[model samples]
Target: MSPTVASTGRVPVTIGAMESSSAASGGSTRREATRQKLYEAAVTLIAEQGFSATTVDEIAERAGVAKGTVYYNFASKSVLFEELLRHGVGLLTASLREAAERTAAEGGNKVDALDAMIRAGLVFIDRYPAFTQLYVAELWRTNRTWQSTLMVVRQQAVAVVEDVLRDGVAAGEFSEEIDISLTASALVGMVLVAALDWKSFQAERSLDDVHAALSRLLQGRVSGCR
Candidate 1:
């Protein structure tokens, strides 16, 4: 049989898959945490001292990892920055997915679920402003790898939102004629743009205010008249 096995009777087969996954997950999580620390250090230093002058050595020093460790984790400064962008995107994706899944499980409608996701994204950026700033700064860079990775992440977000909208349409809560895929992406884009612009306003406004604004915008744009 394959190395990975599905469970059967009480004590019939092997636990290799479980062991392997546990080990792999442990290793991957440790590495990911290390990489995150280095990314945070690099972003912090770059934000403080400008990217042109922020050396990888200083990042390693601040992250308390060896210089070679940094190199092993990321090929070079640019790759490190790329991974930092990926990390930030990954954080937002995870948060959005969890919130959307929870909302769906609770029988929330598509528009309500999407509003929760938008709020989650705002909260993620608020919680990790340094990482979010790094991502925003390099968003328009012409780096192909970064561009492709971001596109993939954005596509995933669009796919999830599309699924939610399609479900809503099936449940007679949304307009079936609407292009759910494009509408979902457009909704995400609107929230991202608005939240980026509203970051400065966050100091004076609460998250509830931001969520309410996004809820109104999305409900107006995507909600059915039923």
Candidate 2:
């Protein structure tokens, strides 16, 4: 599960699949909390300092855990970062899926579902800017031990947006001329970059303001009346 940026001032977030597996493994709540601290510290430091520049001692100090605790949860810094990527991306995918499914259940049209997802994306980044920052920086960087895993996790989230676009095209809600896969990737990129930009440089802007901007962008993409 991705750690929410402490600066978002939001409640702690679930760690998606990581929570379940760790629980079933008989890991105690104390261990989980320690791991959560490690994740939070790691993402923030790595986001600011880059993976290699950040050290286990720094992570431990940030988390208020000992250096030994970092080793207890993860064998190496790379392993912790790898699991952090999985947990973070897994939560993102889950959020998108939830937004889409819930919108559909509420009788929202495909376009509405897509809009809800866009808002979800915004909320996610607002709550986890550190993770978003780290992800965007490392996404295209090759030669990293976890680069392949990161790509897979990224595709999982993109696939959610792609499915929405695909459905819209099938129902004629979207232009058939649209390339759903490419558009999906573009949409994901747009939200991530926009959220990062807003959070970093436009702190005065309301979340709704950012959401509305992206929503307008998406609406403009439709050929017919939205």
Over the stretch 38-130, how does candidate 2's per-residue lDDT look in tens digits?
887788889899998998899898778899989988998899999998888888889999999999999999989999999999988888888
Which stretches of model 1 miss by more than 4 angstroms? 1-34, 45-54, 64-66, 140-145, 221-226
TM-score of 2: 0.88
Deviation (Å) of 89 in candidate 1? 2.3
Q: Model 1 residue 139 lDDT?
A: 55
True lDDT of residue 46, candidate 1:
69
- lDDT scores of the candidates, listed in order: 0.68, 0.84
Residue-level error in angstroms, candidate 2, position 206: 0.8
Candidate 2 residue spans exceeding 4 A from truth: 1-18, 22-27, 221-226
